[model samples]
Target: MSEVPPRAATAAALLIDALRRAGVRYLFANFGSDHPAIIEALAADRERGLQAPAVVLCPHEYVALSAAHGYAAVTGEPQAVLVHTDVGTANLGGAVHNAARARVPVFVFAGLTPFTLEGELPGGRNTHINHLQDTADQHALVRQYVKWSYDIRTGRNVPQLVGRALQLATSAPAGPVYLTGAREVLAEEVPVPEVAADRWGPVARVPAPEAVVDELIADLQAARAPLVVTSYLGRTQSSVDKLVAVAERLGVPVVEYNAEVLSFPHDHALHLGDDPHPFVAAADVVLALDTDVPWIAASAQPPAGAKVYVVNEDPLQESIPLWYLPADHHVRADSGLVLDQILDRLPAGEDPRAARRAAEAAAAGRRIRAEHERAAAADMAAGRLTPATVARVIAGLVDEETIVLNEAISVAPEVWKHLPRTLPGTLYGNRGTSLGWSGGGALGIKLAAPDSTVVAIVGDGTFYFSVPSATYWIAQRYGLPVLTVVLDNGGWNATKRNLRRQYDGGAADRTDRYWVNLQQSADFPGIAAAAGQARGTTVTRFEDLEDALRAGLDDVAAGVPAVVSVRLDPISHQAEDPV
Candidate 1:
């Protein structure tokens, strides 16, 4: 091991040391002119055989941020991200939104222009682009999305500032945090402060109050019809077990709305359907656990006299500007901790109607499962390859060791319906409605859990947004073999549906509308083949779907990334009214 450097070391070295002490393993970065000092520092540290975070070079800013998002989501720990000053930061807007919405802790760092115009130190005002890129308020670009933003003006304060940023980012309602450093400041010498390895201790999860737990228990025992709704309940594997145990013990049904992660076992008896509208409408008491939008109020509302209780780290959803969910009691605490407390405070005996309620919920779950199977069979019988059929086929091929990352917006309902996720950390999706998150996120997930098979299911429109060439190249270079399945529906199906919903029987509702159509689909398989390190295949017939998926999975198992594209029929399910 390399000895500790002198106190008068570059600020970048101190920053790197602080990050390493904070348990950061990887640094996802996109290099640029402004990053020379930090780059040199990292190179020097490696040359001396000092322990430092391994750097992963990303082809684009979005890929870098999204990769960090994926790693954090899987490990429940923040990773570092470095980008160029202005243009690079702008490219991360969409990715930052996804991280914030998912509540993933990410430490974002960017290089700023030199503070001194004249040559005062190394890496100070070397190029004309530096002057052109410098801005008075670079932090403003990402302030709205991050939990905290700061400018490291002095080299001596780098360690303290970085420590604080990590603390805030991993605290309650964890999210991304941003920090900017000027070239001159980073190159300057600074005194190394005596900081502990775990300077910022693990984030303290706030538990629900005794009174709140008692009240919730009383309501659960009294209510004849109760429901539990959650979106991100399975942040950790232990949390998933706790949530399931609490719901089963109380005989309450759980409905996962726009689920981004597998919170409860899909095959469990107390597990209600994914659609929360019907359950919310009929529930006498609703327990919302980390759900942002439980139900669409315009389409379905809870009973007028229903007692709605919400338990989340951030009950208000501070990232969203205008959030108005009806709740009778708002307990600001960690969802997993609250569930544990509720379970601990349970009364001696079960509810009088617990057995009956459990049986009814189980029956409802069976009906929902049957309906999904029938719909898939009907679609197959009609000789049309539907998303549900594809999902079921894929689900049948993989086991608990496979991880599925989904960015299939229009086909999500089918994906959720057919693919039953029982293992924790087996499913992930875009929580922020971003198009390209899954592809890059899969790479990060694979890096975090290299032993598991990582598969990404994306739509044609979302596939292009994923920058497939860059993602696949990174996979091949890093020896990360991920299986990517493209659901090619010819055009932007979601956009067309939205347009028709708003402009039905109007001029814009015509099929020939220019903005609604994504003409000339590319051969995704061909693009993947061009990467030289990956194999690609295309399936046009439903009979070939299973075989193609199996072949792709085989390639992944052999340490080779593969892409399988399925040309789907351009049928709009949204055109029909809801049943």
Candidate 2:
């Protein structure tokens, strides 16, 4: 005879059970008093030996949401967040957009006043909530951005409904889910089901269609000067290994497209940087996998007779110039699945060109490295805040697990070289040109991997404009800590460079837009401590660098999100104001 669980479990208990069944092990929470019933239920679970929720306190809703995004995206397990009422959701709106754009799966839970429970004074202060009692309308605000949103209605239906929500959140094209629980429903009793054991970790095998593989083999076998371009496929560890294998078999070049992140190690000889225009123009055949196609051939000018092949699930139909480049063929399916197909078809015989081409790429990679070093050394000698040194020091601090969420446009390449990634450890900045995305993303990464230290390497311009106020919540409130390493070089280095390049030898600082160039020296560490009582430090001496990095990581690991501000000399290339 089996014992059935009690019917006295509250909505919180039911919801928590659903998450546990789905293999949820951690929460990135920022609490509020929008509803007492839900709060009390969580408290009761903690008391009754259900195990205290492993919660990471974050500084702001943006940070909380961003951390959740990173955790879910990398781990391939859905992350959880508890947003307050309307105000809290509004504050987190930008970060929510960032996650939605990334297609990362997370559950954004919020509490709205129950229509039945509010006395005469339900809508205390949430202006967006109609009254103290509200409908599920407020919860739907995230629908355009998140995959799904729901308000838990009755207690009796909860245990099952929660499971459905989990399914939707972790499904393919994974994105965030928004759920609301009425205060009264959260208090009501329900028959509890035993927590379902985790049956999913991350789905790794994507079986390629054999028919497609045959066609691809025929197409690839004909390519004279073939090239491989990769995108978001870096989501899985197998991605790098698979892509590397496929490229090597053909003795072809593998380039990372819009490679805002380290898709393949820069050290690989085959890895031509993202802008393969130079090589693509000459390539007899170019294959793009999981990339936004237009970006690979948008200039309306590819080399004559170059054939372009695409492999992706969704062949984007809107505003995409499909005919601009000579379309050789299209395989509409998952990227990993397609790669698996190609691997199966690779011939067993050794490729003579493989060694030679790889050697050439390796040599080229070394030359590029030397050029970068000379440029960095020049900037270091210029006595301005160079982004290179700041990136170098920060990159050296991260191990294989650490993630760097960077938003500096001018110094991205230098940063990539200084701290190249092992497979699947790094995430790129947003592809949409959204500036503040990295600050929120760093927070999201921390929430997702609570045990792993996350660092947001921001440019001085980005920190001052977006992240300066973002850390208050993490440092002062919910205790989830992430170190923000600000690369302060005093101005918009990238923008000025672009402007100077566009205009021949123009005096950029002539207008010197004082706003673009800060007129006053900022006391960054002092400002950081004041914003959220974050332990702050200024790194000026190379001798004191390692210790500062260790201290920051330790504090963040201990749940005290801190900021390390480094002031570097500007790269000397901007002396004439490239902008």
Please give each candidate's TM-score: 0.96, 0.81
Relative to the true structure, candidate 1 reaches a TM of 0.96
Predicted structure with the largest TM-score when compared to the true one: 1
Candidate 2 stretches with Cα past 4 Å from truth are 1-5, 116-140, 190-206, 293-301, 317-327, 353-360, 381-384, 394-402, 426-454, 464-482, 491-510, 513-520, 531-534, 539-562, 568-579
Scored against the true structure, residue 401 in model 1 reaches a CA lDDT of: 61
Global lDDT of model 1: 0.84
TM-score of 2: 0.81
Residue ranges of candidate 1 with Cα displaced over 4 Å: 1-3, 510-514, 571-579
Q: Following a full C-alpha superposition, what root-mean-square deviation does model 1 have from the true structure?
A: 3.4
